[model samples]
Target chain A: MEKIISLHNQHVKDWKKLLTRKQRKKTGTYLLDGWHLINEALTANVNVKSLIITSDQLEEHDDIVTRDFPIYEVTDEIMRAITDTVTPQGIAAEVELPTDQFDIPESSRGAWLFLDQVQDPGNIGTMVRTADAAGFTGVVAGSKTADLYSPKVVRSMQGSQFHLTLRHGNLDEWIELFKKQHFPIYGTQLNPEAKNFRDVAPAGSFALVMGNEGNGLSDNILSQTTSNLYIPMNGRAESLNVAVSAGILMFQLNQNIK
Target chain B: MEKIISLHNQHVKDWKKLLTRKQRKKTGTYLLDGWHLINEALTANVNVKSLIITSDQLEEHDDIVTRDFPIYEVTDEIMRAITDTVTPQGIAAEVELPTDQFDIPESSRGAWLFLDQVQDPGNIGTMVRTADAAGFTGVVAGSKTADLYSPKVVRSMQGSQFHLTLRHGNLDEWIELFKKQHFPIYGTQLNPEAKNFRDVAPAGSFALVMGNEGNGLSDNILSQTTSNLYIPMNGRAESLNVAVSAGILMFQLNQNIK
Candidate 1:
C-alpha cells in the first residue's frame, strides 16, 4: 500500500478537488465517504478509481483492499484535509461520475420524477432516494437543481443514485418528449383548481414534476402539465417539504404500476 | 428596548443556556432563531418570553417589535452567542415550551403519528412537519427520539412545531391508549408477512408508527401493532429515509380521513 503523511502531497491536492462541484465536473469523478457508500458503489459496479484510507482503517477494510485498485494509506490529519465533513470517516473512494445520457425507452411505461430547480442538497438527495424506492424509471434533474455529486447530496441519497437512472435534462424538452409518447405529466401545485392527489389513480406510465422549495412548479411548467395535483393539507402548515411531497406522490402514482 | 453589548451580561448568560437540551427542559423555554420562526410564534400566539435582535434587525422586523414583549438589542457578537447557527439570523426569541400533555379525546377520529426512537434530529423534525401537513392530530415522539427543540430539528421543522401537537411519550403507553380508543395503529416494517401499504384503506382515525433510522420498530413495539405495513421497494435501494417513509404513509393515510 502507498503511504502518505504530508498534507501538501500532490496527490492529496488533486483528491481535495473532488470536494467541489466545479472540480468534480471537470475531473468526471467525486469522492464517496464511509464504508457503506463505498460498498454500495462496488455492488452497483460503479467505476471506483482508487481507495484512500487511514492507516488504522486499512486493516478494518481489508476486503476492499483485496480489490485490484490502488490503495493509499494516509494519516488521520491528511484524511481530514481531503474530506468536507468535520470528522472524516477515515475512508473514502474516488468514483467516476455516471455519464450515460438517459433516453426514454420505446416501450417505457414506468414512472419518472422530474425535479424543477430544487436547491437544497438534502431535499434533492431525498427525492432521488425516494424515486429509487418507488421503482421509478429515472430522475430528470432540472438545470437549477442542486448538483447531484456534491458530498452533502451524495450522503443524503444514500447510494440510490447508483441503483436507478439519474441524468440532467431540460425539463421542457423532457415534458415535450413525454407528451409525444402519450405519457401523462402531473405537476404538483396547491392551486385552488388543482385536484387532490387521492383523487388520481395510478397509471402504468406517468411523469411527476416536483418544484422548488419556496415556489411550487414554475408557471411555464405548470402550463404544460396534463393535470396538477395537490396533497391536501388538513393542518396549519402552508405546505409539505418538497422532498416529502415527492415521496408521497411518487409512491402513490407508482404503486402497482408495474 | 434593553441594550446588551457585553457578552458577559447576566441575562445573556441565562439565555445561552437554552442552547442545551437540559437547560431548555429546566427553564421550560427554548431559543428560536430568525424572523420567520419568531413571527410564527407571535402569529400562533405562542408565549414569547423575550425577543433578542441586533440593532439593524429591529427595523427590518418592526411588526414583531410592535408586540408587547421585552425586546433586547444585543451586539452582533452577543447575538451569535445565543444562537446555534453560524450566521446568526440577526434575530431570535426565547419562547416558552408547550407544556400541554397530549391525550386522545374519547370521541377523537383524527389521525396521529408515533415516532419510535428516530434518532436523527432532521428526520424527527421532518416527521413532525409531515404529520402537521398531513393534518394529523398530533405527533407522539418516542423517548429515544431526537430532542424536538434541538437547533437542527427546529430548523428542519420550519415552524411546524408551533402549528401541531408535539409531545414526547412512552410508545408502550401511547400504543395502549391508541388501542383502547379503537384507533388502528399501523407499524412500518419490511416483514414478509407485512401488508403492502397500497392495499390498506384510509380510515377516519389511525395511528402510524415510524421507527429508528438503523432499526425498524423494536420487537416489543412491533408485537403490539394492529398491523404492519411495508412500502414496497421497486428498486435496489435497501430502504427509504425514515422521514420520507413517514411522509408517504402520513399523507396516504390522512387523505379522505377528514
Candidate 2:
C-alpha cells in the first residue's frame, strides 16, 4: 500500500487546505473525518476522491482500504496535520462537493425548509437533520448561512446531509417560486400579529422559513409569507433555540400531513 | 464602592473557586456571567450574593450596582481571573443555588420532564429550555446528567433555568413515584416494540424520560416504563439529536394540553 510520512507531501498540503472555506470552494472538495462520516459517504455513494488512514487504523478499516479509490497510509503526526478536529480520528476522506443547482419543481408537493443567514454551524446542521427526519423534500441555505461542508456542521449533521437534497440559493427567489406555485410559505417570527403555529393546518406541500439566531425573519422575507406563525412560549425564555423551534415546527407540520 | 485590584484577595479567591463543581456545591453558590444572566437573576428575584464588575462596566450597569447587595469594582486582570470564558463579559455575579427538594405533587396534573444520564451540557440545557417553553411544571435531572450549573449548560439555557423548577435526583425513584400516581410515563427508545409517538394521545399530566446521547435509556429503566415511544424516522438518518427529539416530544405533548 502507498504511504505518506511527510507533512510536506503535495497530497498532505492539499488535504490540509480543506480546512478553509475558500480552499474547499476553490477545489470543489472537502474532508470528512472519523469512521462514521467516511462510512456514510461510501454507503451513500458520494464521490470520494481518496482515503487517508493512519497506519494503525488501516487493518481495522481493511474493507475501505481495499476499495478502488487511492488509499494512503500515514503516520499519526501526518494524520493530525491534515484534520481540523482537536482529536484526530486517524481516518479521513476527500469527497467531491455536490454543486448541482436544484430547480424548483413544476408542482410543489412536499415540504421544503429555507434557512436565512443562520450563522451557527451546529444550528444549521441540526436544522437540516431535523428536516430530513420530518421527510422534507430538501433544504435551501440562503447566502450568509454557515458553509454546509464545514467540519463542525458535518459532525453535528450525523450524515443526514447524504440523505436529502441540500443546495445553496437566494431564499427570496425560492420564496417567489413557491408562492407562484400556490404553496403556502410560512415564516416563523415573534411578531404580535403572528398566528400560533398550532392554528395553521398542515398541507401536503409548503415551505418553512427559519431565520438568524438573534433576529427573526428579515422584514423582506416576512412580508412575502402567506402568514407568519409563532410557537407559543408559555414560560419566561425570550425565545427558543433556532434549531429546537425548527424541529418542533417540522415534526408537528409533518404529523398532520402523514 | 470597594475596588479590588489584587487577584490574591480572599474574596476574589473564593469567587474564583465557583468555577469548579466541588466549590460551587460546598458554598451553595455559583457564578453568573455576562449582563444577560445577571439581569435574569435580578428579574427573577433570585438571591444575589454579590456582584463583580470591571471598572469600565460599572457606569453602564449602574442600576444593578446601586442595588442593596455588595458590589465590587475590579481591574480587568482581576475580572479575567474569575471568569471561565475567554472573552470575559466584564461583569459577573455570585448567586445562591436553588437547593429546594421538589416533591411529586399529590394531584399530579402538570407535565414534568426527566432526563437520564444525558451527559452533553448543551443537550441538557436545551432540553431544560424546551421544557420551559412547553410549560412543563419542572425538570428532574438524573444523577448522571451534566451539572445543572455548569457554564456551558447555563449559556445554552439562556436563563430558562430561572423560570422553572429544576432539580437533580434518581430516575428510578422518580419513575416509581410517577407510576404510583397513575401518571403515564413514556420512555423514548427505538425498540421494535416501541409505539409511534403520534399514536399516543397527549395527556394533561405525565413524565417523559429522555436518555443518554449514546446508549438511550438503560434496560432497567426501559423495563419500568408504561410504554416505550419512538419518533418515526422517514429518512435515512439513524436517530435525531437528543435535544431536537426532546423538543419535538415536549411541544407535541404540550399541544394537547392547551
Candidate 3:
C-alpha cells in the first residue's frame, strides 16, 4: 500500500485529469470512481493501474488490500480533488481507456441505435445502460456526442461499456457501410414524411437513429433514414426525453424483429 | 416590476424553503426554474404565483419581457437562495400545484401511467414527460414519491407537468378505484412470475404502474394488478431504468390500444 498525502502527487494529478476527454485521450487511460464500476472492471479482467481510496474508507475496506493492483490511500480532501462527483465517493480506480476492437458481428444483425450529437453526460450514460438492456448492438456515438471514457459516462453506463462492443463511427461512413451490407436506418421525428414506428420496421438488419436533446435527427441523418418513425401521443408533451425515446424505439424494434 | 435588494425578505426566505418537500406542500406552490419551463407554464396558462429573476438576466432580456406577470428582480445571491440546480439558469417561476381540474371526457379511454413510490425526482420528472408524449390520459404519482413540485422534478419534466394532468393519489385507494372501474393494471416488474408486456393489452382502459427506485411495487398494489408486465432484456442489466421501462411499456400499450 502506498500513502499519497500530497495533492500534487504527479500520478494523482494525472489520474484526476483523466476526468476530461482531452486528458484521457492524451494519456490513454480513464478514471473510474465508485465501487461498482471498479469491481466490474476487476471481474472482467480489465487491467487496473492502481486503486485510490480515501483514508476513512481505507480502514473499512479490508478486501482491497490483497488485490494485485497497487493501492494508494489518500485523505478525503485529496480524493475530492481527483473526483468530479459533488459528494465524492471514497473509491477510485485507473484503467486504460478502451479502444474499439470488435468487428461488427456477421451473426449480430437487428436493431442498431445511432446517436447524433447527444451531449448530456447523464443522458448518454442512461442511454448506454438502456441500450445494453434493450439488446441493441452497441450504440454508435457520432462525432458530436460526449466522450465514452469520461468519468460521468463510465458511471452512467453502470458498467455497460464493459459488456458490449463500442465503435466511434462517423454517421455518414457508418451509413454507407451498413447500406453496402444491406442494412437500413430508422429514425424518430414529427415530420409528416415519417411513418409511425409501428408501421415500418424492416426485416433482418437496421439501425435506429436518435438525435440531440433539443433537436431531433440531423437533416443529413434524417435524409439517410430509410424510414422516419413517430410514436403516437395524445398528451400535450412535445416529445419524450431523448434517451427514453431511444429506449422505447430500441426495445420496440428488438421485440418486433424476431 | 418589483425590485428587492435584501436577501432577508420574508417571501424570499419562505420561497427558499421550497427546496424541501415539506416546505413546498406547506405553501402549495413550488419553484419552476429555467426559461423553457417558465415559458411552458405561461403557455399552458398555469396559474403563476410569481416570477423570480436575477437582475442581470432581466436587464438583458428587456425585449422578450418588460411585461406579463409580477416580475420580482432579486440579486444573484438571492436567486441562488431558491434554486435546486447546480448552476442557476437565472429564471424561475412559482406555479399553482396542479390539481385534477380537467375532466377526462367519456371518450377518453386508454392506458395511463401510475408511478408508485418512485422517490427519484429526476426519474419522476422524466416519466411524467414520457407519459405525456405516450398520450396517457394522465399520470398519478402516489405516496413516498419525490414531491412533484421539487425543482429537480420540475426541470426534468421539461414543462410536461403543466401540459399534463398530474395529481397525487393514495396508492391503495387508487388501486381499489381502478379495480372498481375495471381498468386493467399493468404493473412493471422483472419477477419470473410476471407476464411479457407484449402478451397483455387491457381490453378495457389500463394503467401502467411503475414502482419505487430501490424497492419496486409493494405487495399490496401488486396484488391489485390485473396485468403484470415485464420489459424483456437480453443483457447483464436485468432491469431497465424505471422511467425508460415505463416509457417503453407506455409506447407499446399506446400502439396496441390504438
Candidate 4:
C-alpha cells in the first residue's frame, strides 16, 4: 500500500488513464478498485503488483497487509479522485494483463462466452460473475469492449473475473483461431432461422458469442460461428440486455455441455 | 423549442433530480433521452405527456411531433445539465407515470415479474425490457427496488415500460392480490428443493419473483411465492444475473402458460 496525495503523482495519473480505451491499449494494465475485488484477485492467485489503501480499511485486512508493505494514508478526497464509484471503498489495486482467450486449452467441457464489443463495464463484470456461476470456461471480451480491470468492471464482476479466464482483443482473429481448432461457436441472432436455445443441446466443445449490447455481431464474427441461435422470446420487446442474454445462453448451453 | 439558460430553471433542475429516486417519486414523471428511446415510446404508444427536443432532431421526426406542448430548446451545455449521458441525443422526453401494471385485470393472458430490491437501475430496466419481451403482462417493482423513473432506468427500459404495465409499490400486498385472484407466483431460488425451470408448469396466469443482484430473493417474497424455481446450470458458476434468470424463467414459464 502506498499513499498517493497528488493527482499528478506518476502512478495515480497513469492508472486514471486506464479509464479510456487508448490508455489501456498503451499501458497494457488497468486499475481495480474496492477491497473485495483485490481480495478476489488474490484468491484467484493473481499477482498483486501494487495496492493503494487508506488507513481505515487497512486494519480490517491486517492479515493481507504485513509489516513488509506500507499502507497508504490518503484522505477520502484523494481516494475518490482515484475511483468512479459514488462511495469509494478506500482501496484500489493493479494487476497484470490477462492472457489471450484463444490460448485456452481444449477442456472438452462447459460453455465458453464470447463478447463482441459488449461495451458497458457493469455488463462485462456481471457476465463474468454469471459465467462463473453458470460453470463456463470463461468470458472473452472482444475489442472495443469496456476494460475488465476498470473499477466498474472489477466491481460488477464481483471477483468472478479473477476466478475466470477473461481474455480480450480482436474477436475476428480469435474466432478464426477457434474455428481452426474445430471449436463450435454459437452466435446469437434474431431471425426465424435461429434455433431456440432450449432446443439446442448445450453440451459441446463450443463457445457462445454475445454481440454488442445494441448492434449485435458483425457479419465477420457471425460468419465464423457454427450456429446462430436465439433465446426464445414470446413478447413484443426487441431484445434482452447483453449481460442477461449471456447469462441465459450460458445457463442453457452449460446444460448440454455437461 | 424554448431555450432556458439558467441552471436553476425549474424544469432543468427537475430533470437532474430524476437521477435520484426521491425526487422522481415527488413528481410522477421521469426523463427519457435519445432518439431511439423517444421513437420507441412513440411506437409503443406509451404515454408521453411531454417531449423535449432540439429543433434539429424535431425536424427529422415530424411524424411524432405535434408542436402541442413544452419543447425545451436547450444549448449543448443546458442539455448536459439535464441529461446523465455524455450526449443527450439532441432530444429528451418526459414520460408519464406508468400505473397500468396494477390494472392487468387478473393476469388473463401473460405472466408477471415481481422484483425485490434489485436496486441497480440498469438491472431493473433490463428486467422490465425482458419481462416485456418474454410476454409478461407487467412488472412490479417491489419495495426497496430501484426507482422505475430514474434516468438510467428510463434509458435501460428503452420504452419497454410503456409497452407493459410497470409499477413500483408494496410487493407483499401485490402478492396477496395475486393469491386472492388465485394466480400462481413463481420465485427463483437456489434451494435444492426448487424445481428446474423447464420442469415446472405454470397456469394461465403467473408471476416470476426475482431478488437482488447481490442477495437472492428475500424470505418475505420467497415465503409468499407458490413455488421456488431454479435455472439449472451444468457448470461451476454459482448463480446467474437476476434479470437474466427472470428472462429464462419468464420464457420457460410463458411457454407453459401459453
Candidate 5:
C-alpha cells in the first residue's frame, strides 16, 4: 500500500485545496470528508477518483483498499491537514463533479425544487435532502444560489446528493423547459394575488421555487411562474426559514404519492 | 453617554462572558447581538436590561439611547471582542432570561412541539421558528436538547423566541400534563404500527414530539403517545433533516388554521 506522511506531498496539498470553490472547479472534483459520505458515494456507484485514509482506519476499510481505486494511507497529521473537522474522521474521497443539467430528461415527471439566490449552504443542502425524501425528480440550484458542492453543503446534505439529481443552471432556462412540458411552476411569495398553497392540487409534475433568505424571489422569475403561492401563516412570525418552508411545500405538493 | 473604551472594563468583561453557557446561566441573562435583533427585542417588549453600542452607531440609534435602560458607548474593538461574528454589528443588548415553564398554563390549548435530545443549536432554533410560524402555542426543549439561549441558537432563531412561549422542562411531565387535558400526543417514528401522519386530522390542540438528529424518538416516549406516526417517503433518502421534518409535520398538523 502507498503511504503519504508529509503535508507538503503533492497529493496532500492538492486535496487541501479542494476546500475552496475555485480549486474544486479547477480540478472538476471535490473532497468528500468522513467515512459516511465516502461510503455513500461508493455505494451509489458515483465516480470516486481516489480514497484517502489514516493509517489507523486502513484495516477497517480494507475492502475499499483492495478495490481498483488508488488508496493512500497517511498519518493522522496528514489526514487533519486535508480536512476541516476538529476531529478528522480519518477517511475521505475525491469524487468527480457530476455534469451540470442542461435539459430535463423525457422520463422526468415529479416535483423539482428550485433555489433562487438562496445563500446559506446549510439551507441549500437541507432543501436538497427534503426534496429527495419527498421523492422529487431533482433539485436545480440557480446560478445565484450557493455552490452545491461546497464542504458545508456536502456535510449537511448527509449523503442525499448521491440519491437525487442535483444540478446548477439558469433558472429562466429551467423554467422554460418545464413550461414546454405543461408543468406548473409555483413561486412562493406573500403578494395579495397569490393563491393559498393548499388550494393547489397535489402534483405529479411541477417546479416549486424558493428565494433568498433576505430578499425573496427576483421580480423577473416571479413574473414568469405559472402561479405564485403562499403558505398561510396565522402566527406572528415574520416568515419561516427558507429550507423549512420548502420542505412543507414539497411534502404538501407531493401528497399524490401513495 | 457613558463610554467604555477598554476591553478590560468590568462591564465589558462581564458582557463577553455571556458567550459561555455557564456564565449566561449564572447571570440569568444572554446577549442579543446586531441592530435587527435588538430592534426586534424592543418591539416584542422583551425585557432589555441594558444596551451596548459602538460610538459609530450611537447617533443613529439615539431613540434607543434615550430610553430608560442604561446605555454604554464602547470602542469598536471592544464590540468585536464580545461578539462571535467576523464583523460585529456595533449593537447588542443584555436581556433577562425568561423562567422555564414548570407547568402548562391553565388556558394553554394548541399545538406544542417538543424537542427530545436534539443537539444541534441551529436545528433547535429553526424548529422553534417553525413552531412559531405554524401558530403553535409554544415549544418545549427537553433536558437533553441544546441550550435554547446559546448565541448560535439565539441567532438562528431570528427572534421568533419572542413570538411564542419557549420553555425548558421534562418531556415526561409535559406529556403527562397534555394527556390530562385529553390532547392527542403524536410521537414521530416509523414502526409497523405507526400511522401515516396524513391520517391524523388537523386539530386545535395536540403535542408533536421530534427526537434526536441521529436517533428517532426514545422508546419510552414512543410507547406512551396516543399514536406514533411517520411521514411517508418513497425516495432514496434515509431520513430528512430534523428541522425540515418538524416544519413539514407542524404545517400539516396546523391545517386547522383558517
Candidate 6:
C-alpha cells in the first residue's frame, strides 16, 4: 500500500490525465471512477493496473486491498480531482485498455452493430449496451465515433462493455469483412424509398449500420450495404435519436429472439 | 425593440429563473433556447410570450423580429447567463406552457406513453421524442418524473414537444380513463414471466407505461395494467436504458406501421 496525499503527486496528475482521449491513447490506460465499474472490470478479469481509493474507503474495500494489485490511498480532494464525476465514489481503478483485435468469424452469424461516426458519447455507450442486451456478437465503432473509453461513454455503458467484443475500426473495412462472409449488411435511411425495416426478416448473420446523430450513414457506406432500411414514422418527428434507432433495429433484426 | 444589456436587469434576473422547475411552474412559462425550438413553437402556434435575441442575431432573424411578438435584445454574455448551454444559440423564446387538460376520447384510439417516475431529464425528453415519432396521441408524465419543461428536457426534446399532447397528471386517473375506454394498458417488466412483447399484437389503441431508471414499474401500477409485458433480451446486459426500451416497445406495439 502507498499513500499519496498531495494533489500535485505524479500519480494524481497521471490519473487526471487519463480523463482525456489523447492521454488515454498515449498511455493505453483509462480510469474507472466508481466501485460498480471497478468491480465489473475485476469480475471480467480486465487488466487492472492499480486501485486508487480515498483513505476512508481503504478499509471498506478491504476485499480488494488484499488482492494482488497495487493500492494507493489519497485524500478525498485528490480523488475528486482525478475522477470526472460530480460526486466521486471515493474508489477508482486504472485499467489497461484492451488491444485485442476482435475477429469476424468465417461464417459470421448474429447481430453486429457498426457505428458510422456516431459522436455522442452517451449515444454510443447506450447503443453498445443495447447491442449487448440484444445478444449482438460485437460492436465495431468506426473512426470519428466518440472514443469508446472516454469517461462519459464508460459511465453510461454501466459495465456492459465487459460483456461483449468492442473494437474501433474503419467502417468500410468492417463492412467489407461482413460482405466477404455473405452476411446481409443493413444500413438505415429516412427515405421511404428505402426498404422498411419490418419488411426485412431477421437473419442469423447480419450487420446493422447506424450513423452520426445529425447526418446518417455516409453515402459511400449506404452505397455499399446489401440493402438500406427505414423505420416508417407515421408522426411528424423528423428522425429518431441515433441510439434509440439502433436499439429498435438491433432487437428487431436479431430474429432468433422469438 | 427593448435592448437589455445589463446582467442585473429585472427581466434578465427573472428569465434566468425559468431554468428551474419552480420558476417555470410559478410563471406557467418555460424558456426555449435556440431558433429551432422557437421556430417549432411558432409553427405549432404555441403561445410565444416573447422573443429574446442577441443584437447581432436580430438582422439575421428579421422574419421573426417583425412578427407580432415582443422582442428583447440582450448582450451575448446575458444570453449565455440566461441559457443552460455552455454556448448559447443567440436566440431563445419564452413560451406559455400548454395548460390544455387533454381529454381522452370515448374511444381512446392511439398509442399514449405514460411515464412513471422516469427521473432523467434526457431520458424523459428522448422518450417524448420517440413517442412523437411513433405517432402516439400523447405523453402523460406522472408525478415524480422529470419536469417536462425543465431546460434539460426542453433542449433534448428538440422540437417534438410541439408535435404531441404532453400532460402532467395522476397515473391512476389516466389508467382508469384508458380502462374505461377498453384500451389495453401495457406495463413493462424485465421478468420473463411477463408476456413477451413480441407475442402481443399491436393494437389500434393502447397505453404503454415505462417506469423509473433503477426500478421497473411499481407493483401498484403493474397490478393495475391489462397485462404486463417484457422485451426478451438474449444477451447478458442487465437491462436496456429506459428511453431505448420505450422506443423499442412503442414501435413494436404501434402495430399500425407495416
Q: For residues B130-209, could you state the per-residue lDDT of candidate 2 as single tens digits?
A: 89988888888888887888878888888888988887888888887788778889999976579887777665678889
What is the alpha-carbon lDDT of model 2 when measured against the actual structure? 0.85
B198: Cα error in model 4, Å: 3.3
Which candidate's TM-score is highest?
6
Give the chain B TM-score for each candidate. 0.94, 0.93, 0.89, 0.88, 0.94, 0.95
Candidate 5 deviation (Cα RMSD) = 1.9
Point out where model 3 deviates above 4 Å.
Answer: A54-64, A86-89, A101-110, A256-258, B53-69, B75-77, B84-91, B99-110, B256-258
lDDT of each: 0.84, 0.85, 0.78, 0.74, 0.86, 0.87
Summarize candidate 1's per-residue lDDT along B1-258 as a digit string, tens digits.
Answer: 888999899989999888788998898888899978987988889898898989888877677667788999998899888886778889989999887643434444568888888899988888888888888888888888778888888988889988877877787888887788887889999765798877786666788999999898988889999999988888877888898899888876775685
Runs in model 4 deviating more than 4 A are A1-11, A14-29, A67-73, A99-110, B1-28, B43-48, B59-72, B99-109, B232-238
RMSD of each: 2.4, 2.3, 3.4, 3.3, 1.9, 2.0
Residue B116 displacement in candidate 1 (angstroms): 1.2
Ranking of all candidate structures by their lDDT, best first: 6, 5, 2, 1, 3, 4
Residue B112 in candidate 4, Cα distance off native in Å:
0.7
DockQ list for all candidates: 0.81, 0.76, 0.72, 0.63, 0.86, 0.90
Error of 5 at B49 (Å): 1.8
Per-residue lDDT of A46 in model 1: 86
Q: What value does the lDDT take at residue B107 in candidate 3? A: 33
Tell me what fraction of the real C-alpha contacts between chains A and B each candidate also makes: 0.94, 0.84, 0.90, 0.73, 0.91, 0.92
Tell me the tens digit of each residue's lDDT in model 3 across A94-196.
8876655223443346567778988888888888889888776677788887777777777778898887667665877777767877787887897656777
Q: What is the C-alpha lDDT profile of model 1 across A1-258, one tens digit per residue? A: 689999889889999988888998788899999888988898888888889999888877677667888989999888888877878789999999987643444444578899898999999998898898888888888887778888889998998888888878688888888888888999998865798787876657789999999987899899999999988788888778888889888877875587
Q: After aligning candidate 5 to the native by TM-score, how far in Å is the CA of A103 from where it should be?
A: 5.8
TM-score of 6: 0.96
B90-203 per-residue lDDT for model 5 (tens digits):
999999888654455654578889899999999999999888878888998898888899999998888888888888888888888888888889999855478888777655
Per-residue lDDT over B120-177 for candidate 3, one digit per residue giving the tens place of the 0 to 100 score: 9889999989888877777777866667777788778888877667767676666666
Runs of candidate 1 with Cα error greater than 4 angstroms are A63-65, A101-109, B61-66, B101-109, B202-204, B256-258
DockQ winner between 3 and 5, please give it. 5
| Ranking of predictions according to TM-score | 6, 5, 2, 1, 3, 4
Q: What is the RMSD of candidate 2?
A: 2.3
